[model samples]
Target chain A: MPLLDLRGVTKDYKLGKTVVHALRGLDLRIEKGEIVAIMGPSGSGKSTLMHILGCLDVPTSGEASIEESQISSLSEKQLVELRGHKIGFVFQTFNLMQTLSAQQNVELPMIFQGMKKKERAQRATELLTMVGLADRVNHRPNELSGGERQRVAIARALANDPEILFADEPTGNLDSESGGTILELLKRLSTEYGKTVIIVTHDPDAAAIAERIIHLHDGRVVEEVKNA
Target chain B: MLKDFFMLAARSITHRRMRSWLTVIGVFIGITAVVALISVGLGLNKTVEQQVAGVFGVDTFVLVPKGSFGPQRHAGGSSDQYALDLEFLKSIPGVKVAAAVRQRTGFVQGPTKADGTSTQGFLPVMGLSTELVNEFESFTGKLTVQPGGRLFLPEDKDVAVLGADTAERLEAKVGDTLLIAGDANKELNLTVVGIMAPNDEEASTGSSGGFSAGMQPAQSKDTIYVPYDTMSLLWGEASDVLVTLVRTQPGADVDEVADRVEKELNARGSEVSSITYSDISDAIGTMTTTVSAFLAGIAGIALLVGAVGVMNTMFTSVLERTKEIGVMKAVGARNSHILTIFLIESGLMGFVGGVVGTLAGLGLSALASMFIGRFFGVQMAVVASPALILITLAGSFLLGAFAGLWPAWRASKLPVVDALRYE
Candidate 1:
């Protein structure tokens, strides 16, 4: 069975007297150890699809399964657990808390998991070391390079050792050198760690690193290609 | 969890250092006012009660010739025929000591006076038994003869012992001659026997300048004491009104004795009127309560206003941290966490305010007490009762919690996504 499955998913928003169809009749399947990049322009409903799959929002109709557990049928509490324990998220803006140091930011998700402080600290240190940010652990987000901040956000996403990693515009806020370094880390995270990684991006250069690429326009998949 | 909460609270307060300090000051004034004013009031009430109790010690009841409704009301129309006779005093059971006091108001004539060194007007002269002097001294336990001799002896009919200032005014000393004169056939050529030491209230007020200098004038300076027998002999039936004083046995219920004395005096004749020690004390208590209520009402209003200030601050905090609230909620914090954090913050503000206010109050009360002791001839101190302090702290805590309620609720009910989107 696929690690994740979505069948005829639809999301609708009511804006006063009008209705906005954010996602309509979408079907997708993702297997373990696959690196897929979802490429789209703005207003193509890709973000809505990503939000639904992350369990941050539910689809208006249809079914979603993560690790064979039907996520759309779960309660709000169960949805939280699914998001907390199984899926990790990275945002384009490098959503690192400004007040916290890089190491503290990484340890935040583990805090939600009720891990002991000593254990959480040990793991957070290890992950920052893995992301080439061992020396920047004590530095706040503003004190770090753009690539370094995104690395901290990635470390935060991995704090629970999630089964699937989701990156939204993973290299959008970086120069070529930093952006290339982040894409290399993503490739390593999928290939070496054997984790399923999905990235949503508009840059073809960034998408070229993915094992498989799905092109989307106007809320529908337009083309698919395999990376050489 | 507790540590985390405390650290968060301390850090947050420190982050807004100026605001925190200003809040602390506001709360401090409120706390101090409550503690100091109430305490001083308590202390003054205690001192007044103590003075009154000392002035008329245990087991003693006073009798006025004409009946009056309250102790404050002085009786009218002195009747010479209805005076308390010595025989009637000796007849009452359980009355170990008794005296009938006859007061006459007069002034001392200056001898060879200089200009501006006028004859001082004296406090009313109460002619009583030699035993009455002993009773007063024993009750107060501090009265001493400061200069040149003892009180008048019963047989020494033409002698008088002047108060300290009265002796200076009349220019008389022990064995020095003075004409003790009053109106309507009351006059005596008496020798000054002794000058008593100044009382506590008198000594404090004398150096503090008279009434014009925000100080009460000394009541002791113009007082004189002479034997009841001596006054009667000198005046020759001119002094007729009697103020009788009686004391019951130790451990005996005073009210019972008072009732018994009243019954006995009434049985002898309706002309004898008695006032128990309880009556004057009760009247004094009522007056103190009324005064305290008036004063505390103003302080309470100040505290209420402080609470309003706290509410305003909390409302501003809620508006300022709206985005933070959303982030916390999105991070999986429940509504209870949001509520608790804000409540704890407000309560902490109150607690700090309470501490500072308590200190401020103490300082204010001390100043007040000094002024009272200096001028009013009444000793007042800033009282620090544990109950009062606790009440003050609790009041601030309640005010903090009460003020934070709406803000906390507003924070808790914020939609997570909208809050995250708020600037």
Candidate 2:
């Protein structure tokens, strides 16, 4: 069975008196240890799809399963547990807590997962070291460079040893050199560590690193590219 | 979870240190006033009780004439100004010593010697039996003659004791002769045999009330102490004389004795008014308690104002921590957890305020007691006790908790999404 499955998924929103359909009867499947790139222009429902995949937003209709457990029907608390224990997200803005050190930020997910402080710190250090941010453990977000901040975000995404890592335009806020480094890191996550990595990006260069790419236009998948 | 709540609380306080201090101060002032007022009131209550016990002595049934509510306005009222008769005193059973006292005014000459500096001062003359001396001594110990001789004995009917001021004014000593006169111009020669000290300078100068050996402005300077029989003989049965002082055995209830005395006196052909020590003490007690409560209630107004200040500070704190509240909620903090944290923070502020206010009140009361007592000649002591302090602290914390309720509820109800999006 696929790690993440979606069948006939539909998401609708009410903006005042007007109705906007964010997702319209979408069907998709992603297996374990697979690196997939979702490419779409702005307002193509790609962000909404990412939100559903990451368990941050619920679908209005349809079934989504993560690890064969029905994700769409889970309670909010259950969803939080699923998010904390099974999924990690990397936002484009590097949404790190400003008041917390980089190390504390990385350990946040494990803390939510109810790990002991010592164990959480141990895991956080290893992940930070993996992302080449070991020396910046104590630095707050304000003290870090853009690339370093994204790296910290990447380390945080792996804090609880999640089965899937979701990166939403992870290099969108970085310079070309920093962006290249982040793409390399994501590629390494899928190729070397065997994490189910999903990247949503508009940049063709960023998408090139993925083994499979799905192109979306106007809230629907238009084509698929395989780079075997 | 508790740890997280504690850390959140600590951070909340640190981030808004000034508002926290302001809230604390508000609660502190309220607690201090409540405690200080209660303590001082208790002290005054204790003092008055002690004074009444001392003044009334063991068991005494005093007969005072009742005042009239009539049109006439007089010091003793228009109650048929009659004194206790000597016949009734000699008749009553279980009655030990019945001394009839006759009050009159006279003057003393300030040492008219061979050099001649004749200064005349007025004094009050209390003419009574030798037995009545015991009653006078018990009421005001200064009523005793300190030196140069003794009080009037039954045999020494023509001898008198001089108050210190009376003696100083007249420059008279033992064996000195002074002429004693009455309201009816009845005059007699008396020898000054003893001198007594005044209760205090203020009491001596007639500036305050309470018993004093010195002559008051209303009394005679040429004060005389003669035997009751001598006065009876000098001015026969026509002059009214029924007021008598009666002393009971120790531990006897003075109220019962006074009631019995009143019945006996009324049965013997004369109206009676019995003045028990309990009457005066009760009056003073009621008056003191009323005044203390009134002043305390007024002080409570200031405390209410302080509570308002605390409420305002708490509201500001809630507003400033909106973003933080959002973050906590997003991290899975329940609504009750958020409420408890705010309550604890507010209560802690109130508790600290209460402690500081209590200390401030104690210091102020002590300073006032020391300085004001010396200047005003009234004894004022601030009595701070542990029970009172604890009550004040608890009361302040309650006030703080009450103040935080609305703010805390508002904070906890804020939507997590909106709060996270807050600036």
Candidate 3:
């Protein structure tokens, strides 16, 4: 079964008396363990698609499902549980809680999962070590470099061990060297763990890491490119 | 989950130390005022009860004129011509001894050394029987005879007992002679047989009420007490009964006897009233409660203002952390979790405020007591028990939680998508 599927999904944004169509009947599917990138310029509805696929939002029409559970059919509480346990996201800004240390940030999703301290601690420590931030576990986001902070966010994203991970402009705030390292981490995550990875960005270098790139325009999939 | 939320709340509060402490200050000031006033009120209540109980014995029934409270009032011709006949009072059921205490302004002169003419100091003189004086020493007003002196027997003539201050002013030791002259200079030489030891616990309040206080200040200190026979001689001013003390038999129903005494005195055309120690104590208790409640009400107003201050701070905190709230929701925090975290934060603020206020209030009460003792010569006691502190802490915490409810609810209801996008 596909890891993520969106059929005839439409999302609309209302501004005063105007209804802004953010997405228009977008049909998409990604197989399990695949790396896909959705690329588009501003106002191309790529951001809205990212939100729907990440479970942070639902489509106004049509079915968006993760692991066979329909997003639009879930209650608020069910939605909360589904996203908390099955979906993970990385942002362009790192979005690490400034007050939390590296380890605490990683443990946050597991906390919502109702995992005990000892269990989540062990997993969080292992994830941080995997991201090469074991020594920086006690440092807050402000104390870490851009690359290190992003590494912590990646570790946090994997804390729940979701089947798929979504990156929204993941390397937008980092220098090229740091950005390359983050891309390397995402590649390692999918290749070794057999997890599906999706990247939403306008960065060609970022899309280059994906097996396939889906280009969106005016809320529709306009072109597709396969990476060799 | 609760533990996690509490830790989160703690971290958030500690992050903005100055603002949290300022919010706590608002709550603590109200708590301090309330605690200090309660402490002082309790102490004053203790002192007043002890004084009233000492002067009016539980087993004794006392009578003053109708419409008057103290025994020393309305002394002209003695309770409307019936004169509180001691023999008649002793005839009542359950009566052990009944005696009338007569107080009059007397001219007192220290030993004149054979004819050396000394100035006279007008002081109040009270007369009671020797047996009644002995009973009074044990039950009423904590009166005691100092050493090197003795109470006068019925056969003993021209003998008197001096209160502590009276003895000091007269400079008369036991056995020294003083001339006590009544109205029209009708004088007699009296030997000081005994001196009363000072009553230290209640020096000023209850002791002054029933000793012809209206005619002259009824002080336990400067009053001279003589036998009933000596007072009857004017000394000789027509047997005016100031007050009557009626002691009931041991274990007898004193209230019943008190009712009978009042009825007998009033039934034969004498206007008299009976009073017990409980009545006086209850009256003082009511006055203290009213005053304490009034002052506490003002403090409660300040506390209400403090609660509003807490709400204001929480609202600001929720607004400032809007983006943080978004991030938290993105990480899988449920609305309930967010709500609980904010509530805990505000409740912790209030609890801390209560704790600090209780300590500061105790300190303030102690300082106040010291000043009152030094400047006003009144020893003000303070009572701050552990239970009171605990109650205050809990109350303040609840106030904080209640104040934070709306803000916390707003924080919890923020949209996850918009919150993540919030700056």
Candidate 4:
């Protein structure tokens, strides 16, 4: 069974009197250990799709399932549980809490999972070390570089040992040099960790690092390209 | 989970240091007002109790003509019309001794002669039987005499005893001769046989410049004492007893005695009422409680205003952290977690305010008591129990939590997608 499966998913938002179709009849499947990119221009519903897959939102109609559990059928409380344990999300802004240290940011998801303090601290240190930030564990977001911030966010995403990881425009706020390093780190996550990684980006260079690229236009998949 | 939330809230409050401090100050002002005002009021109640205990002995009751207990009515009456049946009062089982007292206001010429003119002032003149004078001395446990003077004898007609304050004001020693102008312009020259000790009890009950309409000034420090025969000589045959003092036997119920006296007076068709010392004490207690509650209520308004300030600050905090709330939600925080975090933050603000305010209030009460003691000559004791402090702290904390409920709920209910998109 695929790690993530979606069949005829649709999302609609009401903008005053008019209905805005953010997604329409979207179908996708992602298996374990696969790196895929959903590439689209602005307003093509890339973020809406990421939100639905991450369990931050539910589709208006149709089916979305993670492993054997139907996402659309889960209650809000169950969704929160699934999101905390089964999935991880990294945003374009690197959303590290400014007041927390890199180590604390990484330990946040584990804290929600009711992990003991000593164990979560140990896990956070290991994760930050894996992200090449061993020396910067105690540094807050403001004290870190753009790439370091994103790395802290990625470490936080991996805190619960999630089965799948989602990155939404992960390199949008970084320089080209730091952006290259981030893409390389994401590729290593899929290859060495055997985790299903999904990246939603409009930049072709960021999409090139993924093994599969699904092109979306007007909220629909128009092309599929297989890279090495 | 609660610990984590507390840590998060603490971090948030510390991040915005200035706003948090200002909010705390607002609550501090309110709590301080409540603590200080109520404590001072309680102190005043204690002072009044002490004064009443001193002036009217615990076992002594007063019998006055009906409606004459009121100071305004007492001033309007002809003393000749109000007379207590001393023999009948003494006939009661619990009545140990009964003494009829005649009180009148008169002008006494002082020993000081300014340009050959004697200084005179209005002073209270009390006419008492020698037996009653001895009872008063025994009740007070102190002899009413100056350093080198003696109390007047029952048959002494031309000798007088002056209160310490009156002696000081009149510049009259124990051997000096003073002139007194009594009712109907009757004049008498009497030798001062003794000078009484200064009465601190009178200062507490005397006119201190507030609303004292229905209350009459008790026998104060500025008074002179004479035998009943001497008073009769000055006022002629119309001198009637003004009030009667009844002493209850040791260990007897004063309330029962007072009730029996009232019943007997009513049975004999006498328009007189008897009041026990406990009755006066009870009235004073009720009045003090009411005044304290009223003052506390006014202070509570300030606390309510402080609560509003806390709510406003929490609402602004929620608005500013919209994006952060979205991030937390996306990272798997439940609505309850968000609610707990914000509530903890606001509640901590209130708890801290309570602690600081209680301390500040105690300090302010001490300062006020010092001022009162210096100016009014009455020592006030401020009361602050640990239980009261704990209640105030808990109450302030609950107030903050209540104030933050709506804002925290709003933050928790915000749509994740829209919140992330907020600037």
Candidate 5:
């Protein structure tokens, strides 16, 4: 069975007097340990699709499921639990809490999961080390380099040991060298760590690291290709 | 879990140090006003009550004619024809002792000026019954004579005990003879027996200024005391009883005895009012409550403004941290978690204000006590009861939480995606 499946997924948003369609009857599937890059323009519903799959949002009128549990059938509480334990997100701005140290930011998700302090602290250190930020554990976001901040965000994303990792425009805010390093880390996470990595980006270099690339336009997928 | 939430709240508060303290000032001002004003008012009331209690003994009751002034009712009458029935007063079950007081203004000539000099103008000369010759000191509890002098003895005639200030004015010493020129130009000599010491309680009560200041009808420090029969010898059966004094047995409830005495006195077909120790204290208490209520009105208004300030601050916080809220939601924080965190933050602001305000209030009350003591010569025992402090702290916290409820709910209800995208 596919690790994640979507069928006829649609979402609509209302702004003032007009109804805006963000997604339209999109069908897709993702298997375990696969690195897939979803390439799309600004209005191509990339965010809406990523939100549904990450459990941050639910589909408007279709079935979106992880394994056997349908996203539409889950309660608000269950949806939050699913999001918390099953998926992790890395944003373009590297949303590491500005007030927290790198290690503390990584421990945040585990804190909400009610993990013990000493245990989560040890794991946060290990996650930071895995993201190649072992020496910058105590540095705050303002003190860290752009690359280091993105690594901290990735460390935080993996804090709860989630099954799927979503990187939204992960390289958009980084210089080429730092961007190359982040894409390399994503490839390594999928290859060695067995995480099903999903990259939502308009960057060709970000798509180059993925095993499959899906193209989207105007709220629907248009083309698919395998990376060389 | 709650600790973690509190830590999170503390982080947010510390992040915006200036705004948080500005919000806290709004609350602490009101708490400070309430705490200081109420404490000072209560302290003044307590201080005056203590002074008045020391001035007048609680175990004794003084009964006077309703319309009498300065304990002098008439110019001439025997005990039997007097306004009050001394025998019936002495017959009361709780009445351990009774004394009939007679007082009037009279002229007396000192030893050097006797034959040709007219005399000093009329001053208050009070006479006490034989029962008071020794028992008056014990019954009154606060009155005492100088160390070298003695009270007038029952068997002794034509002797006087000069009040503290009156002795200074008269330049009369113990063993000095004063010739009294009576109603019909009759001459009498009285030896100075005892010179009364200054009443410290009366001195304090007399000098202080407050609403209840001078509430205790202060006895003149210039009065002269003599035996009841000697008064008749001086006045020739003309002086009438002005005030009646009754001392109740120790361990008897003074209020109960006072009520009984009041009942008996009222039954005499007169409109006289009998005062008890509780009456004086209650008068002070009423004044304190009135002052406190007026202050509480100001505090109520201040706290209302403080509440609005807290609500406003919380709403602004929700707006300012919109993205932070989104990040927290994305990280697995439920809406209840967000709500609780914001509530705790606001509640903590109020609680801190209460703490600081209580300290400030205590400091202000200390200054007020010093001012009253120095300027008014009134000793004030300022007290901030632990109960008041605790209640104030708890009340401020609850008020903060109540004020923050709507804002926290609004924060928690914000759409996670939009909040993440908020600038």
Candidate 6:
């Protein structure tokens, strides 16, 4: 079985008196260790798809499966547990807690998993060191540069050693040089660590780094391309 | 997990120090008012008990005219008409000694000195039987002649004793001649055989009503005492005994004696009521409880205001940390985790407020007691028992948690998608 599977998945939201369709009849499969990008325009349902695939939301109809388990039938608490153990999310805004140090932020995911303090601390330090922020472990988000904050967020996402890492416009806020470094780090995460990676973005340059690109338009997949 | 939530809560509260402090101050003021008012009320209650005990002595009861205990009623009749049957009162089962006291306000002239001038003052003149004078001496050690003076003997018909303040005011000492005049314009001459000590004066004065009257006895600092026979001789058969104080055996039940006295007096066609020290002490206890409860209720309003203030602050905190909450949810924190964090934060605010408020209240009570002692001549001590502090602190914490419930629920129930979208 593929790492993630979706069949005829549909999502709808109520905007006051109107029903807005965010996703309609979507079918997709992502294998383990694949670097895939979901590229679409602003209203093309890329974010809605990411939310469902990450277990942060449920589809209105049809089924979504992570590993071999069906996600659509899961309760809120079960979904939270699944998300904590199986998926890691990196946001475009680098949403790190301002009051927490880099090491503490990285340890948050494992903390929720009830990891032992000494072990989580050791893992947090190693993860920060792997993200090239070993010297900045004690620095809070406010004290770090934008790129460094994003690095800390990336380190945090990998804390639980999730099966799949999801990045929603991960480098959207950084300059091109910093954004290039982030994309390289994400690419290496798939190539070197054998972790499945999903990136959602409108930037072609970001999509170019993915091994597979799926283009979405008006809540439907329009094209699929495999990069050399 | 709880520890993590506690740490998160602490960090959040510390992140917004100014707002947290303001919220705590609101609660602190409420708790302070409650603590200070209750402490003072308890202190006053205790002081009244001590004063009453000191004035009335132990195992003692009083019998007063029936309607006299209500208020000073001026019925259109002579004061001499309301007299108790001394024979019946002295015959009560537990009566060790029943003393008949005739109280009157009269003018007494001090001795003419070498310069031929005398000072005069209107004072409460109590006429006691010679036997009762001895009872007073036994009940309260040595009522007359503190050091250099003489006690009133059965043969001493026209001698008088002066209260300490009255003696000082009249410039009269032991053996000084005093000219006493009754309200009926009858006059007599007597020598001051003794000057009573200041503390003894408070116990010797006659309290007109029983304990239920709740009246502080007339200040004995300015008064004179003469034998009841002398008062009756000068005023003729018109003199009446206003009140009779009956003492029970040391181990006898005072309340039972009082009830029997009332029953016997009523059967004899005498209109009178009786009260014991227990009655007055109970009344004082109830009065203090009511006052404390009333003041605490007012302070409770302030506490409710403080709770509302905490709710408002928590709501604002949840709003301010919306994005942070989203980030937490995204990082695998459950709704329960978010709820726990916020609840702990508000509870900490209340707990801190309780501690500081208790301290502030205790300090204020101390200061109030100092002023009360200086101005009222009564020492009032704050009852800052550990049990009280523990209850206050725990109460404050629970109050905070209760106040934070709605806001914390709202925070926990927020959708991760919407929270992330919030700016």
Give the whole-model CA lDDT for all candidates, comma-separated.
0.71, 0.71, 0.82, 0.82, 0.80, 0.83
**Which is the winner by DockQ between candidate 5 and candidate 6?**
6
Query: lDDT order of candidates, best first?
Result: 6, 4, 3, 5, 1, 2
Which candidate, 1 or 4, has the higher DockQ?
Answer: 4
Ten-residue stretch with the least lDDT total in model 6 chain B: B208-217
Ranking by TM-score: 5, 3, 6, 4, 1, 2
For residues B192-310, what per-residue lDDT tens digits would candidate 6 score against the true structure?
Answer: 99877665435434332223121112345577878876777566542356767788887988899889989888887766677677877888999899999999999999999999999
lDDT of 1 by residue, B1-423 (tens): 444444445545666678767776666666676677677778877776666676567787766655553653455664532455565666677777776656566554433345545354544565657766566443323345665588656577767767777777677667766666676766676677777675566555433321111111134556676678765654554235445667777777777777777777667664666666677668777887777777777777777777676777778877877776754554444566677767777777888898888877877888888988799766775677888788888888877778778888888878655565467
* Tens digits of lDDT, candidate 5, B1-423: 788888888888888899999999998988888888878877878887787666457786666555332233453332322345556767877888877666767886654544555335567777777775445443344445788898766697789888877777777788888776557776678899888877677543443332111111135567777787787777765235665667799887777886787678668743344556686678778878898889878877888888899999999999988988888888888899899999999998888888998899888998999998899767798888898789889988988888899999999998888888888
**Residues A1-228, model 2: lDDT tens digits:** 999999888888787999888788888889898889999888888888887887766888989888877877887667667776777778787777665789988876665555787888888889899999889899989999999999998998888778899988998999999999999999899889889999999988889988889887766677789877
lDDT of 3 by residue, A109-197 (tens): 88877889999999999999999998999999999999999999999988999877899898899999999999999998889998789
TM-score of 2: 0.64
**Tens-digit per-residue lDDT, B198-235, candidate 2:** 45553444333433322232233445555676565445
lDDT of model 6 at position B380: 79
1 against 4, candidate with superior TM-score: 4
Which is the winner by lDDT between candidate 1 and candidate 4? 4
Model 1: how far residue B296 lies from native, Å = 5.6
Q: Score every model by TM-score.
A: 0.70, 0.64, 0.79, 0.77, 0.81, 0.78
C-alpha lDDT (0 to 100) for residue B287 of candidate 1? 82
Cα displacement (angstroms), candidate 4, residue B241, comes to: 6.0
By lDDT, the best candidate is 6
For candidate 5, lDDT tens digit of each residue in A1-228? Answer: 899999888999898999888888888899999999999889899988888898888889989999899999998899879778988999999887887899999998888888898999999999999989899999999999998999999988898888999999999999999999999999999999999999999999999999999988877888888877
Backbone N/Cα/C clashes per model = 8, 19, 2, 0, 2, 0
Evaluated against the true structure, the overall lDDT of model 4 is: 0.82
Query: Model 1, residue B79: displacement in angstroms?
Result: 13
lDDT by residue for model 6 (A162-224), tens:
989999998899988888888999999999998899999977888998999999888888899
